[model samples]
Target: MTTTLPHFEPFSPDALAHRGGALAEGPVALGSAGYTILNFELATTVLRDSRFQNAALKLMEDFGITDGPVHEFRAHSLLMAEGRRHLRLRTPLARFMGPATVENIRGILREIIQDLAAALDPSAPVDFHGGIDQRLPARVYCYLAGAPVEDAAKVARLSERTLSLLNRDPSLTPVIVAAYDELFAYLRDLVARKRAQGLGEDMLSFLIAQHDAGKLSEEELFNEAAAMLEASSVNTTHQTGLVVWTLLRDREVWQRLVEDPALIPAAMVEVLRLYPRPGVVSRIATEDVELNGTVIPAGSDVHVAVWSANRDPARFENPAEFVLERERNQPLTFSTGSHNCLGQGLAKVEMEEVVRYLVEHFPNTVVVEEGTDIGQAGGRWLVKSLTVDLKP
Candidate 1:
């Protein structure tokens, strides 16, 4: 027998913080949307368990994308894959996004940051979110996909529109559907052009090579490319902005980071823990599963409240404060287990490089609070506008 789970609305402002203060209430809660795992321990268990599959397909269906190319892609994409097939789909992409490849790309990241920074006027406050964070990830994606640099803006637009399904706005179904159609067409053209122009060492070229080698079918190849493109930008853009916004506002941390550039990575991780972009990782319980004292029925939706878990006192000491030197400071920002974010290494390195550039070039950068707007929606933190004064 199980008692009733308390009602909780995760998207409510300061909900995670409020829930953090009420941990003794239990680790799980029921909401209008679904069941939420509010503690670190249970959240990790649910994330790693194969019984809880990704809710992306369900999310699409809920938006009226029950059949067609977008539906088919989501149903068979890597996010919905399991076991060996998941590994098979993940391995090729992982080689390029893992630590070693990302490290080699660090120099390129620095160059890109420098170039973007060069466009800003140091004497005035600049729109950091618009000018830098929003633009960098798509440029990096272009480099990875072997797409033309001129296509960065278009790539950014496509990514933003396609992944906007996460916003949970039912009215945007048409936009999301059209975006996928455009994306599929763009990828088909890009792939055909790559084959015509001869293959290279870039990721898209490598995927094309794999297809030729009979490792991936035509549809699987397109699905993989679409997955990579859709995921490559929007979240990373907001996260990079969040990192910059958090670090610049904390003068003490900013000074320390400027003094010792070596602390950049740890400091970035601390920021990630506090302000994760993906606040909730939604999943569907494939079978009746008991978590804690509650037996979740089969096909129930489970929302892993990452923001709440990251701040749960049982997991992090001084759960609300920023502690840069905290040992084993691992947050579920990129998640865990086999299905964890494949591009996390690349995302982190991109942010670190951006921070590294600021610390090295403009040590006195500060957030222009009046011009900045940071807020949360659907339980996810997003940078609406971030202005910074780089007193170079």
Candidate 2:
């Protein structure tokens, strides 16, 4: 079905860029056809408020986007859930994903980074996403989910295909669908095996035990596994690119890291603050609410533009500059509040480890061509397609 709503002003990235990156001061209206969109909040507020929904399904319907391999998988992740249902599932996730717990996992994650970076051939042009960056979180996610490290590359391929739903052609749905089924089935069987072994220490094993103990349903286990795999794989890879991009363009950031290797982790935080991969997490307003003096009526779609919010002058000094030492940059990168990413802690650990290795090993790495800006079809800025020459 087409959009069922009122008319409002149009908002597009092209238009905004053409106007020197400034848009109207309030929530810019986006019409699906001729609809008033809804009483919306800035993307950042929408991300934090419980009233809003991801409305991904609603968006697909309005845009006449039919089922495809990638879109189908996206429908299963926690990133798309709203309200009580989201909370119900996310609570346990928070248990293992807390900051302190993640901090403890750094030793193992560091080992992975050291091993992987040691394997890179700096003389050759490597596809950073598929080769280096993807490996950063692929092993971590596999270990967390109780999957075999031997299968990380295979799983990464499935993830790449699934995430392609964001910008891939609708015609590729069949291929991705087939890959997803195989991937999901393999995970389900892995969970079963872990259960048969009488419990596991990893997250997937824990999920399996929960399923058997009635804490989680069968459907929940499968979907959640897919969700975990994809979220862990794609977002991390994209953020790795963000770090590289930031470092390549700014010699000072690189010099700062080289001078103080201990600061790589903090530099990574700055990267997250500047260029987060996952698109703005949005919510559908369930009720009318006032944000910064604007009353958004119920059922509005709110989005907290991660990039914009992170750069808001009110929040950070010199918002546009990349400050690895910024002590007050409370980036909305991992978001805040109840639904904040359950895997953020683990993701950060992986990032820190990878960044450390990259700094220590490739101190003078430079992007030869500076690569192309692989712009996202779905407004994800971090999913850039760029190739560069790496050298000392």
Candidate 3:
């Protein structure tokens, strides 16, 4: 049986969220190359089912991308692993990324965000995306990753180049490959520098200690560091910008947040539900299985339209509207099941603090000129360069 998948503008995240659910109404719809599951309930079932495993590692290998920072970052990261391999590394890393650890750093994060927010020029429009969003996450995570905070700008630049590789765009492969080489060298140097000093309390130090204890290999430690750099910085950066964009775009939303600070948390949840930076989470079927009356064959890739599922009317009331006090507002922004994002705790801490500070400090903040980078595939839903007037 053949299924005709409707054409979706792959570049626009908003369009995908608004149109994907309708286009993929059935249990599962065929995407450009694989099956696309847009139903919220079915996507949850697929996420938890062991038959559907993460395929990012296999996809990268299939692309003939051998070794480098990209390989270290994506091919061996927890997001790409399954079963025992995933557990082996994730167990230790999870401890470091838990709520307690995240809470411990809130004070530091607040200081960083507050300082950045203070630097925003009220007299003229400031490039909020580049000036604050891009820098804050990198600075915070670099400190956590045990890399010198001074090198955050460099790490961010390198990560941006290598991030294109994840989009799986053939035209950008060469540039992405070159970026991997540069990033690999930088990570290697950074790792070496960290090693020269004794283990500290930072995340990278903890991973290095694990390596020394024979739990992870030297290569694994470096790869972990590289992966942490990308995840901690890129995703959080875009999300922070998008959340602010959502708030300021709607005067009522922004005013509400300002008037009632308690609503900030719910506002954050709604923003994430409304606009997940990583629009889709995909998996591959390890064996043929029947789900919601649809037969998914073995070896078939399943693209879970996270953006669509979050806004599915079945799960969310008035899916298009952003309800600050939304009940049971569970969005798959951090994914679901065993492969759920490990850095989600950190992201929440970073976001809540940043948003709170922005709203409180810049009460009259308004978008001046805004644009998005929608060309890339994964983790590319950025407001890109948002010029905002931070005046009162």
| TM-scores for candidates 1 onward, in order | 0.98, 0.82, 0.91
Candidate number of the best TM-score:
1
lDDT of 3 by residue, 1-392 (tens): 44445444433434463543545447577645577777688888889888898877666766777675566567666777788988897888899888899899999998888777777777877888888889998898778878887888977776677665557666777787777677778777877887887778888889988999999988778777777765667777788888888888889989998888788888998999988887777789999988666678899888777888888888888999988789999998888888888889888878888778877778888877434342335523666566677883
> For each candidate, C-alpha RMSD in Å?
1.2, 4.7, 2.7
Tens-digit lDDT string for candidate 1 (1-392): 57688888776666755645235568989988888888899999999999999999999999999999999999999999999999998998888677888889999999888988889998899999999999999999999999999999989999999988988888999999999999999999999999999999899998999899999988889999999999989999999999999999899999999999999999999999999999989999999999988999999999988988888788899988888898889999999988899999999999999999999989999999899999887789999999999984
How many pairs of residues collide in model 2?
Answer: 16
Better of 1 and 3 by lDDT: 1
Candidate 3 regions with alpha-carbon error over 4 angstroms: 1-25, 66-74, 369-380
Instruction: Report the C-alpha displacement of residue 298, candidate 2, in angstroms.
Output: 4.4
Model 3 quality (TM-score)? 0.91
- In model 1, the Cα lDDT at residue 318 comes to 93
Q: What lDDT does each candidate get?
A: 0.91, 0.64, 0.77
RMSD of 2: 4.7
Candidate 1 vs. true structure, TM-score? 0.98
